[model samples]
Target chain A: MKYPGGIKKQGSSSINYANRGMNFEADINVTNSYYINNDIAVIYKKPTPITINKVDYKSRVDAVITEAHFNTPSTTDYNGIYKGKYIDFEAKETKQNYFPLSNIHKHQIEHLNKIVRHGGIGFILVNFVKLNKIYLLEAEKLCSFIESNERKSIPIEYFENYGYLIKPKFNPRIDYLNIIDQIYYGGKL
Target chain B: MKYPGGIKKQGSSSINYANRGMNFEADINVTNSYYINNDIAVIYKKPTPITINKVDYKSRVDAVITEAHFNTPSTTDYNGIYKGKYIDFEAKETKQNYFPLSNIHKHQIEHLNKIVRHGGIGFILVNFVKLNKIYLLEAEKLCSFIESNERKSIPIEYFENYGYLIKPKFNPRIDYLNIIDQIYYGGKL
Candidate 1:
């Protein structure tokens, strides 16, 4: 729920609410940077898309966007390479015990499936903030749960049983890549 | 350069200039989509980043960005999985005989080098728009040239010698993946 310094707040009341939503993403960004700096991996979160409607040309080198709107991303938030393998995943934070199915879009699920089909590693990082637990669940399991029609929300117990737990670290914050090494590479390195 | 239909143009005066610049990207997007639809590959171009300065909230779901500026990208534009291997590259179009090194940033070059060091496939797709020639040059060769300090721009002769020429097709437009298969896998498939 902690907010980073770079994100600007508008209207005093909504600051806390916005920070809580952005904390998970910011933490992952920091973790990825740590990995990159240490030569472990080169994962990165894709930037949020913004559609520009108007631009004000202040100078030849400075064109400021006057009006814009957020655009929906066509793929997952995070993707990169680790040990010659392509890694793709989406991270979601949920306050409830059950993760809502609607948090993920249909195309993103399809994209994850396609990645797996193409022989790349694809998964989801689910953060249950209330309980301070994060699980790295493979995309195959998530897709299966989606197809089974068991419930609208996946219970926390299901993740606890099927997914690998990612231990939060002080240096990297959320060390999800370590969980990746354990699950994908069998902790070989 | 021929412009595609999907890209939105801001004004009439800027249309020609914008379209010319966007053609290469738009063509690659079509080519990627073709590959995706045919179950060949799952490559995607990362969205351009925008730093938000101000926002106007119309409703709970309708928050519009009133002010913003373009943010510099930290890595290459296109990346994805191809045959279980991490594929990463940057595409650039130039009208001159030599490709200017300044067209690419220092961080992007560093990012490409990192990908190669971690056992991933990395390269640059250079398009000579005036000549209608596209070449897929491996990152190792590009880095070597960069390290050698031979010239500020990469001469066309070097690309013709070390790079793989990608033949434009009617269906996919730029069939760079075919060249990838040929070079990376010895055209076994």
Candidate 2:
């Protein structure tokens, strides 16, 4: 397990003892649960898509699952409805100044576009590990960066120029919709 | 992977697949994806609810996921929107003449109750794997079976008496919604 800034791992003395990878997705889920419980919004992270086959329950009928695969070519990390509006975005973090284009795939970008087309707020949550800075960039800006002559990442300078910084926190952390309120609802929250 | 209705494996071929145990979820996902692409409806199998932490990238900051756990119980197996109406249901398969109550959890049953309370459609796609018989049982009736102390499952006689059977098909396979139309709506396809 790693820290919020993606720095040192959790010490052996820490509470968790699981051998599983840091529950990054679980944290978002916890955060989403918080949102749902508070009646603040209803958003959820899509599950890691998988296919199943060959379900063999001895007492139960042996079910045959033919094939399986991860459905998304890229990430559509978070999505839900808030205050009657749909919200969709991907959450990503890198320990570099410039987040790479490799993180955002073409298909993922298109997925965001689809979200926007359907009248949902679409954006990406990017964390600059070294700088310990996080920003929420809209789909339009992301598309331009991908389609730009650089044909690559959006420089840190560009992110600093255009992105809204997100402050990481504790207690159902990564409360992104607060930022969503600012961007989509014009800072009412 | 071994097939449910296919030949069994021997000669020490261990299962080393990510989707080793259950392919029922995967098949439903593929079937759902095909349904989504065909504009049949926008349904998605909820991703495995996970907790993420600890990420390390050379040039970029890693998003370290700290802790994780298996599924933390859920309300439905799949959810989506069809014709602007919320669709929710749990998928269960049994080889017996009756559907066992043990197949469902209390929380899941409660979840379906809430969905109906909120005016959304709630139901189950029950497949008798060995019998190759599928039924679309309304949540209302299910709740009744749950409320009674007479038995822990819906007897086969009851299914044959009241449940809507969903025959497996190739194109637009498992067209359960067609039955929904007949039951929930008055028109026939």
Candidate 3:
């Protein structure tokens, strides 16, 4: 199997072996770069928001931030144009059996709802790290679950039923776009 | 005329007075908020990209960045869904009679070009602050100019001729969408 960093693993029958000890965010970043290079999409993870309080201008191009504080992001971490459609999503990795709603902030959910209302594609990617399973849950279904149930977390079964499983693959790594094509683009891929 | 901060300025017939002493980025931020509040669009200026070097987790909620450095953005400053279309643009305020191409990074232009190629609306908003004139130049025209000429900057005449003029408004302040509607949506606004 093809592993990350272009290394081939001999006799590695499972995808988990390839992803073992790899960072989730880094994997997504690589996948995004792959998509960009292949001219497939233009998705990007937004920079972590911060409020700068102090800076040291060492030179014209060497200004170093001395003090800053993280600010709550008002929108999803990832967003861009995909096939002429506005795609927005947040991704998180959990080591538990259930995906906690608290992993996403309240304002972020509202922001996703607004995106969906404005005719943009909005969803969340939750990776059950321990189970080595990932699911892409649309904003509509997520909001429905929040409204209908009193539970703070969504079980794996619910994801298996409502969310689309994102099987890990070589080259692009996580093939979430495969599911996107199936669901939104009439299986054009 | 309706001034910034919702203050009504009397006997000011020109849009220049309303924008005098006001920061261009702040004006766009206020305009974006107005668009969001009115459900007109979902555009936003991305957070300034930075490379965090060190952080101090004083407590669970109060982690402070002690060292960081600004990183050049790979994409435009603003992008979002507008009328079910992917909208991407970079905004710049130039006090000079010509807008320097150096104001926009090389990769940013490439990124916008890719966006337009992928069926997204891509443009650059050049606000000639001194003339109180703002123009939205589409990616096609911008790239054409870059390809045909050896000029380091675009003259104000080029903007006046080829770019869509964005007139200042009361509630929305910088009404670029008004121009977008006229150009792309058959003046649906």
- Model 3 alpha-carbon miss at residue A41, Å: 0.4
Q: B100-188, model 3: which lDDT tens digit per residue?
A: 99999999999999999888999999888788778899998999999999999999989889998876665577788988898898895
DockQ-derived CAPRI band for the predicted complex in model 1:
medium
Instruction: Indicate the TM-score of model 3.
Output: 0.94
State which candidate, 1 or 2, has the greater lDDT: 1
2 against 3, candidate with superior TM-score:
3
Instruction: Give fnat (model 2).
Output: 0.13
For each candidate, report what fraction of the true interface contacts it reproduces.
Answer: 0.88, 0.13, 0.89
Each candidate's DockQ: 0.66, 0.10, 0.89
DockQ of model 2, rounded to 2 decimals? 0.10
Which residue pairs in model 3 clash with each other?
Answer: none
lDDT of 1 at A56: 96
lDDT by residue for model 3 over A1-189, one digit each (tens)?
455467666543544433532577887888899999999999999999889999999999899999999999999999998898999999988889999888999989999999999999999988888788878999999989999999999999989999998866666877778889999988953
Q: Model 2: how far is A93 from its true place, Å? A: 0.5
Quote the positional error of residue B43 for candidate 2 in Å.
3.1
- For model 3 the local lDDT of residue A20 reads 37
